[model samples]
Structure formats: C-alpha cells, structure tokens
Target: MFKKILIANRGEIACRVAATARRMAIQTVAVYSDADTHANHVRACDEAIHLGGSAPKDSYLRWEKILEAAKATGAQAIHPGYGFLSENEEFARACADAGLVFIGPPPSAIQAMGLKAESKQLMEKAGVPLVPGYHGSEQGPQLLQREADRIGYPVLIKASAGGGGKGMRAVDKAEDFAAALASCQREAINSFGDDAVLIEKYVQRPRHIEIQVFGDTHGNYVYLFERDCSVQRRHQKVLEEAPAPGMSETMRQQMGEAAVAAARAVKYVGAGTVEFIVEQREGGDMNFFFMEMNTRLQVEHPVTEAITGLDLVEWQLRVAAGEPLPAKQSELQIHGHAIEARICAENPDNGFLPATGTLAVYRKPLAHTSFQRSHLRIDDGVREGGQISPFYDSMIAKLIVHGATRAEALARLDAALAQMHIVGMATNVQFLRGVLRTESFSQAKLDTALIERERAVLFNQEPLGLPLAVAAAVAHTVLQEAEGAGRDPFDRRDGWRALGAAVRPFAFDFHGETHAAQLRYLHDGALYLQVGEVAGPLVIGRLPDGETEVEFNGRRHTLRVDELGGTAYIFGTQGATRITAIDRLAHAGDTQAEGGRLTAPMPGKVVSFAVKAGDKVSRGQALAVMEAMKMEHTIAAPADGTVEELLYVPGDQVAEGAELLRLAA
Candidate 1:
C-alpha cells in the first residue's frame, strides 16, 4: 500500500476515505478551500494544504492546484472522493502525467462513460440492453425536437454529461419539448460545460438499481451485489438499500454478469457502478436497461459495504497499488439487509430547497455511538458549530442501519431519525422518517415516483398546537430562572407569589401566526395558562437531563427544548417548531414586501432570466432561474401581470429574499 495519499475532495466522503486510509496505516493529506478551512475533513487527516476560493471551480476543480498540493505533501496517490474532480477524465490524466496514482478507474474508462450519448453507443455495441432513444451526435435543437417527437410524448431530455439529476427534464407533450430542451441544455452547460444532450423514452414504474463492480490491474473483476435506489425526489436518490426487495437469484446473477461485461468492455479498473433503470411489469417479470456508469466511488457505497463486509476504499487503494481482486465472484456473499438515508440540510415542505446557516445545535442519535451495536452507523464531516454554506452540497450526513431482515432495518432507521436533533436550520429528518413509515415503503413497493405518489402524507405539516406552544413558553421561563439563580436554592424565586398571584404575559410567533398567553404563578408552586378562550392549569417538571415534562389535561409529555438567539425550539415526537418571543410593546411595522414582488428564495447566482421587464407573464410561469447549493430553482410569477423591473442580471449573486423583479398589478 502507498505510504501517503491525498484526498482531493471535501465533506463526508473525504472524511470517509481518510478513516479507511488511516486503518491501512497510510498517511492522508486533505485539501480545503477557504470555506472549509475549519472543516471536519481537514481535521481528519495528518496534513492539510490550502486550495483557492470557496467555489468549486476555484478550488476543488482546480486540478493543477490539487496536483501541486499532492506533490508538495509527498503523496504517492490521490483519491477523488465522489464529486468535483472524481469523474473528470482530464484531471485523472493530469494526475498520471504528474507521476501520481489516481485511485479510480483509468482515464480511458472515465472518458468512455463520462458522456451519456457516447456511452450508450458503446453499451449498444457491447451487446448491453439499452433504452429506445436518440443517442446520436447531432446537437441541433430542431434535430433533438424531431427525435423527441419520434420517441413519443413523455420523453426525457437528459444532459449527456449529467449526473445527480442535474441537467435533466421530463417533457409530457410536444409543445413543452422546446422549453424543456433549452432549460436542460442550459443547466448542462452550467453544470458540466457540455450542451450536448440525448432524448429517451420515459419508462413507467421505473426502479433504479445499480451494481457495484470492482476491477484490478491483473484483469480480475467481481460484482458486489446491488443497491435499490428507487426512493427518489427530483430524480435524486433519498434512501437506498442493498439486496433489493423481491430480487430473485436468477435476476441478480443475470444483472451481475451484464454489469461485469460493461466494465470489461472498457477495461475498467478500481471501483465503478453500473446503473440500470428496471421496469416493473405485471406478474413478476422485470426488464432493465443500461442507464449510465459512474466511474468512481458512490455516495451510497456504505450500503454496499454493510451487506458485502468489504471496505471499498480499501479495495481502491489495494487495486491502485497493482494488487489483484480481493475476492472472486463466487467467494463474495451478501450478509444482512442494510439501508441508508441521506440526511440533508433541506426543507422538505418547501420543495426540498437546500438550507444554509450556522448549526447552533447539532446532535446525532446516541444509538449510532454504541460500539456494541455494530449495525448502526453514521458518516458525517460536520461538527456542532459548523456552517452549512451555499458553496457546496447540502448533504449533512448519512445514517446507515443493518439488520437480519429488511423490516428490522426499516424500524431501526425510523427510530434513529426520531432521536436526531438539529437546530438553526431546517432538515429532511422528519421527511425521511415519514417515508420510512409509508405503507408502500413497508411493503417494498418502491419506484422513482414513490415520493410524488405519497405526496399528501409526506408533505403534511401539522400545526404546532396550543399545548406545545404553551409548553415552550413555560420551559423557556423555567430555564431562564434556573440560570439566573446560580447555585443557591434560596435564590430560586420561581412561582413566588408573596404579593398574591402574579400574571406574566408572553407573546410568540409560530409558523407565521402570532399568539399570546398569560401565565399565572400561584403561591402553592402551581401555574395556570390562558390563551384565546382556553384556560387550563399546567404542571411543569424539569428532568435531570434538562428535558421538560409537562402535564396538562391529566396527560404527561416529555419534550426537548433548545433556546438559541431568543427563539425557543421545541422538539417532540410529532416534530420540531421554532417559537420566537415577540415584544408587543416595542413592535415595529411589518417588513414583508408586497406580494407582487418576485424575490430570490435563497442565496444564489442568477442563471437566466426567462422573462425581462415589460414582458407579460402568467401566474406560475417561470420568470428566472437561480442556482444555489448546486441545484437550480425556478422563480415563477405570483400573478398574471407585466414585468415592471428586472433588478439583477445573470451571474449576479443575490441574498435570500432579495427582490429580483416586480410585476405590475
């Protein structure tokens, strides 16, 4: 094995690679941008080097800088962890030219699979089953529209150089094909710098299943079973599992053989994944078509590791060192069922838009830290006070669980999500739990549209009831009194009513609605609350671990309350809610702008303006596109009106809620 290696990436994947390298007694070097100077990955390695700016093009994507850092640190090889330069064929070749080993597939393999248009041709020539579509080299808009019409309506416009659901759009009719193609091509150019695209027939009831394949310099190969990545949102996998539900031995073997053949055709080396779009049919028949091959380690590789009992990164290191395949196809075996949920800092209720902020309070489930339970694991590269900046991916961590059966794994995953607590920003933890508890998921009836199919229950947001709201106010007051009293019990004057019952009024805002309540402190150490025609006496007790227990209407409930920046965040079994204290006496006028203004939802750079000033638009029409957190968000018109002003141009970075345009009423 190489003595020292450089990890040319950031975030959790970089930390993950460092863990494995350290176990192999190999020193690791980490490269970071200005945004990630104090990042977790930098702390995981023995040495670190500074890259450039926070944007990927200025830092992680700078292959020359990465090579310089590697050479300066005396690293013999470089591991491109998943994103950024992982699939850049030119970067791989540059590493080779610098006399440093690239711990991934050969540059030839990356080049062959990097472009979907050409890869489809290669797969077809290799006898791999392919979907019916247009994979030709013609890049004309008219030619692409003609092909889309030929493939019938509901065709998919996909960027030839896209992954992670970027630069792809589904058109349902001929009239929408032109706009969809333009948007797809624009995103393609912005993301991959390639405007070429391919049109394919959209498969109904499609299930995404990919086979993990590995190869060595000695020309040996093996398939590490498969992962079912069918549960997706916006064409990106949210939850993944190994040993796909209802998979038969015969189908597994056939898919495995096909995957190996595709890899051998390119003379693949190191780790790669062969993705397939499997179409479910009546009876038990399924037909799978080759989608694309990822020429590096995958984000969902942990699920593969849990089932196969192999460290894929370690395998990458060994193979890059010219070692033979660790095990033959017949020697590998699937152990137990495993599932992984990608925990992202995103708001599921608001179209899953990525969120950026400082993590005032971050805590993972305690179950993941028990060494006795080897089945539960968490892979993260963030700390409690880290910031989720807009310059990188929004994925905060991945929670993986294993069990003897799929049912057990599902149960464990749900429990773990419930135990997680994150403050200062929204996350998808509750959304993930809702998916795990869905009837379709429990029965393993999964597909790419599962989330959309279960949208009603998945997006349901229950109101923060009066009970919880009252509990939050009381908890806040109790904690404040305790802190002010210091260590002396005599100084604790909570509920003291020597001058008769005292009434304290509290104002709070929850979910855009303001509420007020009055708390009466009785001389007998009791409290009573009255709010909007509801009057009740409540009992509050503090637990040893700082949790609050509230008794109301003869029922007792325990909740965790975190007060930060004058906002009391209460977390219960139902979910979490933020209650900000309002000062009614010193209140100011509302700062919200009128509804006719179109504002940026988050901090991002303007990618394009579909409509300019004086252009008439209808409600729900796309007005502009903003790119943030590596994803594009479309800003639409609120009402049918003429655009009066365009405030910002393309490539201008704007803050959240910055007015981008105004529509004439």
Candidate 2:
C-alpha cells in the first residue's frame, strides 16, 4: 500500500477520499484554491498545498499546478476524486511520466472512453448495445440537423466529452435544432473544451440506470450492481438508488455483464461507471441502451457502498497499487436497498436556479461510519460559515440511507432530510422532502418527468405550517428570557409592566408574507395570544431537548426550533418553516417593480449580449447570456423593447439581481 497520496479535488469528494485514506493509515494531502482557503477539505487531509485562483481553470483544472502540489507534498499517488482532472487523459499520462501513480484507469482507457462520439463507435464494435443516433466526425450544422431528422424528432444532442448533465439539449422538432445545437455547443466548449457533439434518440419515458464496475491490474473485473438515477431536473440527477427497484435478476446480470465487457474493451483498471438509458415500456418490459461511461468515481457511489458493504475508494488505492480484486463476482451480493439524495444549494421554486451565499445555519443528522451499512450517512465538506460560490458545482451535500426494504429506506431518507437545516440562502431540502412524498415517487412509478408530473403537490405554497413555527419562536424567546430574569420588572419578558395588562407585538416574515402575533400578560399570570384571526389562552414550555411545546385552547403541539441570527427554523413532521424576525424600527419603503431593467438571475460572468444598445427585440428574445456554476443561463427580454444600455460586457462578473441592461419601451 502507498504511504501517501494527494486528492486532486475539493468539497465532499475530497473529504470522502481522505476518510478512506485515513482508515487505511495512508497520509493524505489536500489542495485548495483562494476561495477555499478555509474549506473543510483543506482541513480533512494530513497536510495541504495552495493552488491558484478560486476559478477551476486557474486552480483545479490546471493539471501542472496539481502535479506540482503532489510532488511538493511527496505524495506517491494522485487520487482525482471525481471531477477536475479525474478523467483527463493528458493529466493521467503526465502523472505517469512524472513518476507518480494516477489512482484511476490507464491513460489509454480514459482517452478511448472520454469522448462520447468515439466511445459509441468503440462500443458498437465491442458488441455493446447502442441507441440509434449519429456519432460521426462531421461538424457541419446542416449535417447534424439531417442526422437528427433521420433519427426522428425528440432527439438528444449531447456533448461528446460532457458529464454531470452539462452540454446537453433536447430538440422536439427540426425548427428548434439550430438554436439548440448552438447553445449545446457553447456549453460543451465551456464545460469540456470540446465543441463536438453527438445526436441520439431521446426516450420519452427513460430511467437512468448505471452499473458500478471495478477492475484490477490482474485482469479481474466485477460489477457491484446498478443504481437508478431517474429523478432529474434539466437532465441532472436529484435522487439515486442501488439495486434498482424493478430490476429483474436476469436483466441485472445482463447489464452487469455488459458493463464489465465494456470495461474489458477498454482494458480498464480502477473504479468506473457504465450508465445506461432504460426505456420503460407501456407494459412492464424494459430496453436499455448505452449512454456513456464515467471514467472516475461517481457522485452517488455511496448507495452502492451501502448495499454491497464495500469500500470503493479503498479498492481504487489497492488497484492502483497493483493489487488483485478484493472479491469475486460470485462473492458480491446485494445486501439491502439504499437511497441517496443530492442536497443542493438552489431554489427549486425558481426553476432550480443555483443560489450562492454563506451557510448561515447548516445542520445534519447523526452519521454512521463508512462501513456502517444501514441507517444514515452524510457526505459533505461545508461548514456553518463556509461560502458557496459560483466557481464550482452547486451541490452542498449528499444524504444516504439504507434499510432492509425500499419502503424503510424511503422512510429513513424522508426523516433524515427533515433533520437538515439550512439558512442564509435558498436550498432544495423542502423540495426534496416534497418529492419524496409525491405519488409517483412514493409508489415507485419513477421517471425523468416525475418532478414535472407532480408539480402541483410538490410546489404547494400553502402557509399552513406557519402557526406552529410562530408559536415555537415566541415560546423559545419567553423561556430564554424567563431563565435570565430575576425580580427586576424591566428584565421580565412576559409583557410585564406597572399596568394591569401589557401587550407585546411580534412580527415575522414567511414566504414573502408578514404575519403578526400579539401576546397579552394579565395580572393573574395567564397569557393570551392572537395570531391573525386565531386567538386563545396559550400555555407554553420548553422541552429538555431544546424543543418548544405550545398549547392553544388545550391543543398541544411540540416542535423543534432553532434560531440563527434573526432567522427561526421550525422542523416538524410537515417539514421545516423558516421565518425572519421583522425589525419594526427599520425604515419601510414603497415596494415597486423596476420596469425595463434586465438583471442577472444569479451571480455569474456575462458570456455575451445578443443585442446592443438601440437594437429592437421582441418579447422573450434572448438578450444576454450569463455563465455560472459551470452552466450557461440565457437572459431574455421581458417585453418588446429597445436596448438602451449595457451595464457589463462579456467576461465581467455580476452579482445576483444586478442590472445587466436597460430596455426602453
């Protein structure tokens, strides 16, 4: 076994690798950028080295800098945990030439499978099942359009070198092909530095299932199992599970064998995943087509670990050290069902737009050890004061749970999700809880359109849970004040005064609406409370666990309450409700819309403005493009207007809601 290694990534994956390396008694080195100077990953390893700027291009993507960091730290091997240089062929070759072991597949395998266009060609000859599409080298727009038409409408244009759901577009008709292709190519070049693409038939009802395949230097290969990654938004996975719910034993063997064959075709070594697009038919049958192969560890590998009770990262180190496979194909067996939810820092209510800010209130549930097969596990490297910038992926953490059955797994997942508390920025925790409760997901009728099909229930904005939260907040404040108060009248917070009865007013904002509550302290030591139209004699107390218990007219309610800064979080069986305490002394201003101003939706760099000043454009016309979090967002004209001014040119970073352009009616 190697004595030391360098992790060439950051965030959750970096910390994850360090954990395994520590367990194996291997010293680990971490590299960080300017933005992540105090990041958790930097503190995770045994030692650290500084990279360049915060941007990926200046830091993580700079292979030479990473190599030098490894050399300086005296790392024997380089573990490219997931993204960045994980699948870079040139980097792997460079590591080998520099006398450092690359803890992944050989450079030849990465080069062969790195590009989807060429990989499909390799798969076709290797007898792997492929979908009907175009993977040729022709770069002409007309040629690609003709190929799309040939493959029929509703085709997918994917980046030849793309992963993690970037640089992909779906065109339903020929008229939309050109614009979609251009957008896809731009994202491809930005994300993968390759403008080449491939066209394939987009399955209407598709479920993304990928097999976890591992190979060693001794020509030994095995497939651990499959994970269903169907629940998605914008072609990115939100939820993934191991031992696919409806997978038959026969199909499981077939897919596993096929995946192993693909690995063998590449003379593969180390950990890799072969993803397939499974078409769910009207009856019950399924047909899977080859999608692409990820040449590194997958983001959702925890679920596989939970089911198989295997350490994938440890396997990678052993394989790179020229060790044989740990277990044979027959020894590998699925133990139980596992589910993993990717918790991201984004607003599901706003088209899942990535949100960036300090993690003012970050919380997680109880975590089990890496080898602890069942229960809860949280993989993350973020802290309460950490900043989530637009320089990388928007994922905050991953919550994984295992159980004897899928129902139990789902129950545990939902409960664990409720335990997570996030503030200072928008997150999808509530959205993920809502998704778990949807009929399609609850009943296991999952598809890529599950979120869209159940939007009505998933996006329910009814403020029914606000009352408990309000009561909890009031109860907590009263309890805390009562503890520190003596006989002093001014220190008493029970609306006390020299008068007969004193009234205390409290206000909080929830979901853009402000609600007020009044508490009256009577001379008889009883309290009267009223929130909106609901009024009653209230009795409240604090539980030993710091939870608040409140009663209104003999109806008792217990809730978990936590306050950070001025934000109060209440978590109950109905999910979490965050309310901001309103400061009455602050100045109140008139709320009005700023018309004819085009603003950036989130913090990002301006890619380009399609229209300049004095140019007339129609409503919903593309006005500007903003790149953030490794994806490009198009800013469109709100109405028919003439462009008046451009606030920032291409490559200028803009804050969220910054005015990008001025439009005149």
Candidate 3:
C-alpha cells in the first residue's frame, strides 16, 4: 500500500476514507475550501491543504489545485470520495498523467459509465436487462418530447452525466413533460455542465437495488451482494439496507451476475456500484432493469461493509495498488442484515428543502466507526459549532446499524436515530423513525414512493410535542436555577420559605401557536405542570450523563434538552421539537406576513425571474426560481395578481423569506 494518499473531497465520505486509510497505517491528506477550514475531515487526516474560495467551482472542483496539493504533500494516490471529482474521468486521467494513482476505476471505465446514455447502450449490448426507453443522441426539445410520446407518459428524464437525484424529473403526463424536461435540462447543465439527458420508463412501485462490484488490475472481480435503496424522497435514497428483504438467492445471483457483466464490459477496476430498478408486480413477481453504474465508492457503502465483514474503502486502496481480488466470488457471503439512515440537515416537512445553520448542539449515540462488527457506526465530518455550508451537500452524517435479521435491523435503526440528537437546525431524525414504523417499510413492501405514500403519518406532529417540549424546557430551567442557588443563603429557591408553592407560568411559541404552561415547584422535590387543563406532577431531573429523566402522566421517559439563542429544543423518543420560551410578562407579539408578497423559501441564489413588473400571473404560476445546495426551487404565485416590483434580479443571493417580488391583486 502507498505511504500517503490525498482525499479529494469533503464531508462524511472524505472522513470515512481517512478512517480506513488510518487503520491501514496509510497517512492521508485532506483538501478543504475556505468554508471547511475547520471541518472534521481536515482534522481526520494527517495533513491538510487549503484550496480556494468556499464555492465548489473555486475550490473542491478545481482539479488542478487538488493535484498540486497531492503532489506537494508527496501523496502517492488520490481518492475522489464519491462526489465533486469522483466521476470526472478527466480528473482521473489527470491524476494518472501526474504520476499519481487514482483510487477508483480506470479512466476508460469512468468515461464509459459516466454518461447514462452511453452506459445504457453498453449495458444493452452486454445483454443486461434494460428498461424500455430512449437513450439516443438527440438534443432538440421537440425531438425529446416526440420520443417521450413514442415511448409513453410517466417517463423519467435524467441527466446523462450525473446522479444523486439532481437533474432528474419524473413526468406522469404528456402535458407536464415539457416543463419537467426543461427544468431537468437546466439542472443537468447546472450540476453536470451537460444538458444531455436520457429517457426511461418510470416504473411504478420501483425498488432501487444496487450490487457492489470490485475489480483490480489482475482482471479479478467479485460481487458483494446488494443493497435495497427503495425508501426515497425527491428521487433520492433516505434509507438503505443490505441483503434486501424477501430477496431470493436465485434472483440475487442473477442480478449480481448481470451487474458483474456490466462492470466487465467496461473493464471496470476498483470499487463500483451497478444500480438496478426493480419493479414489483402482482403475485410477488419482480423484475429488475439496469439503471446506471456509479464509478466510485458509494455513500451507502457502510451498510454493505457491515453485512459482508469487509472494508470497502480498504478494498479501494488495495485495488488501486494493483492487488488481486481479496476473496473468490463463492467465498463471499452475507453475514447479517444492516441498515443505514442518512441524517441530513434538511426540513422534511418542507418538501425536504435544505436548511443551513450552525450546529450548536450536536450529539450522537456512542457508536463505533470501524469495520469491527460492533453493530453501530456513525460517519460524520462536521463539528459542533460548524456551519452546514450551502456550497456542498446537506448530508450531516450517516447512521449504520447491524443486526441478525431484518426486523432486528429495523428496530436498531429506529433506536439509533432516536439516540442521535441534533439542535440548532432542522433534521429528519424523527421523520426517519416514522419511516421505519410505516407499514410499507416495516412490512418490506418497499418502493421509490415509500415516503410519498406514507406522507400522512411521517409528516404529522408528534402527539403532545408542544406541551412535552415546554415541560422539558421548564424542567431544565428550574433544575439549573435550583443548582445555582444551592450555595447562596439568600437565593434558596427550594419552595420552602414561600407560603404558597413557587409557581411559575411559561408562555411558549411552537411554530407560531402560543401555548400556556404553569410549573409549580413543590417541597417534595417534584414539579407540577398544568397546560390546557391537563395538570400533572412531573419528576424531572438531569442525569449524570446529561440525559433528562422525566416521570409524568404515569410514565418515565428519557429525553435531551438544549437551549441556544432563545430557542428551546427537546429530543425525545419520537423526534425533535423546537419551541421558543417567552418572558413571563410578554404576549406572543408575533406578526404574520402579508400574502401579497412572494418570497424566497430559503437562502439561495435567484436563478431567474419568470415575471417582471406589471406582468399578470395566476395562482400557482411560476414567478421565479432559486438555486440552493445545487437544486432548483421555483417560487410560485399565491393568488391571481400582477407583479408590482421585482426585488432582486437573477444571480442575486437572497435570504430565507426575503421578498423576491411584490404581487398585487
């Protein structure tokens, strides 16, 4: 193995690669942008180099700068950690030209598999089952629309150059195809710098299953089973697992062999994933069609590792060093079930819109990050005070769990997600738990639309969330105050000298609704809380390890309470509830914004304005578009109105809720 290698990426994947490299006694170098100068990946490696500006264009994507840093650090190879330059064949070739090994597939393999159109053509020739669609080289909008009509509606338009749900849209009707295609093409250009696209049959009830394949310079190859990535939102996988539920060994072998064929067609080297979309039909019949091949390590590789008892990143390093296959195909076996949950810093209630903020309170379950069969692993790359940069992907960390069976894995995943607490921003911790509880997921009736299908239960507010959070918040305040007063005679606040109990009323704002709560400090060392006619005596105290224990409503519960910047957050078994604690003497005093103004939903760059001043628009008409975290969100009109003024032009950055235009009735 090489003495040192450079990780040409950031966030969890970069940190993940560093961990494996460290375990193998291979020193690693990390590259960072200005926004990530204090990032955990930089701290994970042995050496670090600063690139340029915060944006990817000015930094992470700058292949020349990355190569220079690798050479300056005397790095022998470069690992493109899943994104940025991972699939950029030119960068791979550049690394080869610079006399440094690229810890991925050969440049030719990346070239053949990078574009979905070409990859589909190659796979079709290789006799891999393919979905019926058009992957032809036609650039005209009318031509693409015509092909969609010829094939059918409910077609998937995807960027030929990239993945990760960007530059992809599914149109269910002919009328919506045009707009979806345009939006998809725009995203394609923005994300991959290629407007080229391919059409595929959008399989209803599709289960995303990808087989992990590995190859080396010795022409040796092996398939590491498969991962079921069916639970998704906005066409992106949210939860993934290995040794797919209800997978028969016969079908597994067929899919695995097909994936190997696709990989061998390109003479694939190193680690690669061959993705297939499996369609579930009536009477338990399933058919899988080739989707595309990811030419590098995957974000969900940990679940694969947990199940196979192997280190995939270590495999990449060794294969890049020209080592032969570690094990024969027949020797490889799936040991147990493993599940992975992608914890992202995004608001699941708001269409999974990305949220950016400083992580004021970041905590995780005590889990290992090794390939040691220890059951739980958390791969993260951000510190407590670090900001979730809008310039990069919004994923904060990955929670992986292993169990003896699928049911055990599901339970473990739910427990792990609840144990993972995050404050100072919105997360899908509870939402993920909700997914695990849903019948579709729990029963293994999986599909790409699993999240959308189970929207009601997943999006519903936790029962008594507001009141519980208020109680937790109040308990926290009371406990801290009582602790501080223990030393001062004049500040004795144990409800002893007071004639009546030391009762305090709290007013809190949860999302916008105000709630009234009363806390009575009792002489028995317990507190009584009254909210909305439900009065209960609460025995709340902070435990030795910072977890709060509360006995109320005839039940004992463990929770986490955090206060930061005037916001009180409680993380319980269900999920996180955020509320604001108001002063004792104050009213809510919250004002609602007028509906006459159209505003940006989140902080992002205004891509373009669909309406100018004096232009008439109907309700639900597109008014403008904004780009955040590399995805496009269109602002629409709330009512029939004429645009009175456009506040910002295209290319201007706007904060969340910043008025983008004035709409008049």
State which candidate has the highest lDDT.
2
Task: Please provide, for model 2 over 1-665, each residue's C-alpha lDDT reduced to its tens digit, 9 standing for 90 to 100.
Answer: 99999999999999999999999999999999999999999999999998899999989999898889989889999999998999999999999999999999999999999999999999988888999999999989999999999999999999999988889998999999999999999999988999999999999888899999999998999999999999999899999998898999999999999999999999999999999999999888999889999999999999999999999999999999999989999999999899999999888888888999999778788888675596899999899989999999999999999999999999999989978888778889999988888889988897888999999887745433666667777777787789779886777766765669888999998888899999888878778888887788888887887777888745787777777778777776667777778887773664576698988899999998899889999998999888989878888888998999999989899999999999999
After TM-score superposition, the amount by which residue 422's alpha carbon in candidate 1 deviates from its true location, in angstroms, is 1.0
For model 2, state the Cα shift of residue 368 in Å: 0.7
lDDT of 3 by residue, 54-108 (tens): 9999999999999999999999999998989999999999999999999999999
Candidate 1, number of clashes: 0
Q: Which tens-of-lDDT digit does each residue in 515-568 have in candidate 1? A: 888888887767887777777787787889878887765567777888887688
lDDT for every model? Answer: 0.89, 0.90, 0.88
lDDT of 3 at 308: 88
Clash list (residue pairs), candidate 1: none
Model 3 lDDT, full chain set: 0.88
> What range of 10 consecutive residues in model 2 has the weakest lDDT sum?
460-469
- lDDT-best of 1 and 2: 2
